[model samples]
Target: MAFSPEKSNFRSPLKGPPSPSWNDLLLKNKKALNHVLFTMHLQSRSNKQTPSSSPSPQIRKSLDFTLPSLVSDPISLLSDQILLSILSKLPDSQRNCNSLVSKRWLNLQGRLVRSIKLLDWDFLVSGRLFVRFPNLIHVDLVNGSLISLGECGCF
Candidate 1:
C-alpha cells in the first residue's frame, strides 16, 4: 500500500478558513452584550459620587433651594387624554398656547382637534404655511390674515 496523502487524509482547499456565519454568533451573544453594556453604564453612573459632577442641572437646581416653603410645586402638565378632553371643549382660538408647551402635546394626533381659528396673523400665517391635518374642516382667520385655499394643493 502506497502512502497517498490525498487518499489517507481528506481536506478541502475550498475550506481553508472556516467562516462561521456572522448573524448566528450575534444573535447568540445579544443578551450577554446587552447585560454587560447596561451594567457598565450603571457602574459609571454610581461611581460619580459628587453632586458637582451630577449630569442633571434640574436636580442641582432642586438642591439649591434655601427656602423649602417658598419653593412652588411644579404644576402637573395635563396628560394627553385630559388635554384632549379639554381641547375638545375649548374654543378653537385657544388651543395653540397649551399645545406649544410640549412636543407630546403637539403630537396629539390632529384628528382630535376639529376646529381651528387663527386669531393672530402670525399664528394663522404659520398654521396655513406649515401645519397639516386631515380632519380640519373649518379655519376662521381674523386680524386680516388670509390663506388662499385654492393656491394650497391640499384639498
Candidate 2:
C-alpha cells in the first residue's frame, strides 16, 4: 500500500500556528472573563459550599462562565413541598428573611409558620389570629395567668 495521509482514517493535529479566531474571541470577551473570574473568586471566598453552589452544571450554564445567585435559581428546581420542608428547618428570623426573596417563597414561608407567639391573650383576641395565620396550629403566650381572652372571634 502507498503512504496516503488523505486515505488514512486518522488525521494529525494542526502543526501550523493556531487560528486567530480563538484569540479574537478571547480579546473580545476579556472584560467578561475578568468579571467571571472575579465573581468566582468572591463565591469561593464565601464558606458556603455545595455542588449547586460550586461551578457545577446549572451554575455553569447560568453563569456561562458568569454565574451568580441565578437569574431564576436552581433551588426553584426543587418541588415547593421539598423547598418548604427545607425552609421549615430555618428559625423564625431566618424564615422571615427568606420570605422576602420572592412571592412564592413568601407564601410558602407564611404557610410553614404554624406557630404564633403573643404577648398575652389580649393581642390574640384583638387580632384575627386565625385569619392572620391560616396554617397556625399552636399559640405561645407570654403571660397566661394574669389575663385570658376566653375565645377569639377568629376561632
Candidate 3:
C-alpha cells in the first residue's frame, strides 16, 4: 500500500483551491522563487556591509545631534502657595535648611514663618525682617537689647 494525494479524499483546510504536492508547486514557480531568493540574498549582503561602511556626512551629523532636555526643576513647577503650605508642615529645625536650597525656596519658606524670635533690633529697624517674613503674626523681642528698640523709632 502507498499514500497518494490524488487517491485520498482529503480536502485543504485553507480557503483557496486545494494545494498540489510540494514537488509540483516548486516546479511551477521555480523561476519566480529563484528571483525572489536572489533579491533577498542581495538585500542581506547589503545590510551586512552597511554597518562596516562609514556613514555619509549628513548621516554622521544627524547621529551626533542631540535634542534639548525635557526635564525641568520640579520645585519650580509648584505654585508659591503650594510650596509655602509644604514648607509650613516642616519641623522648626528642618525648616532652616530649606532656605539654603534656592532664593525661591527661601522666599517661600519665609512666607510660612508666623512667629520669629528677634536676636537683633537692628534687623527689625532696617525693615528687612518684615520684608523677609511678611506673614509674621508674632515677634519675640525678649532676646534683643532693650535700649535699641526704644532708639529704633519703630513705635
All candidates' lDDT scores?
0.55, 0.65, 0.69
Model 3, span 30-94: residue lDDT tens: 56644544454445446777666855778645532321122133235456886787778678788
Better of 1 and 2 by lDDT: 2
TM-score of 2: 0.35
lDDT score of model 2? 0.65
Best by TM-score: 3
Model 3: how far residue 64 lies from native, Å:
22
- lDDT over C-alpha atoms for residue 95 of model 3: 84
- Per-residue lDDT for 10-114 in model 2, tens only? 644765555475348545776675575556454654556665556555655555544444424435545689778878877788888989998888878878867
Query: Model 1 segments beyond 4 Å from truth?
Result: 1-78, 115-155
On TM-score, the stronger of 1 and 3 is: 3
Predicted candidate 1 versus true structure: per-residue lDDT over 1-155, tens digit per residue: 67888667676898796656534644478666444444544455557767566657675455434323332321222345755775666555656665676666565646466566755576555664236454677776653465567646768
Give Cα distance to truth, residue 87, candidate 2, Å: 0.5
TM-score of each: 0.26, 0.35, 0.48
lDDT of 3: 0.69
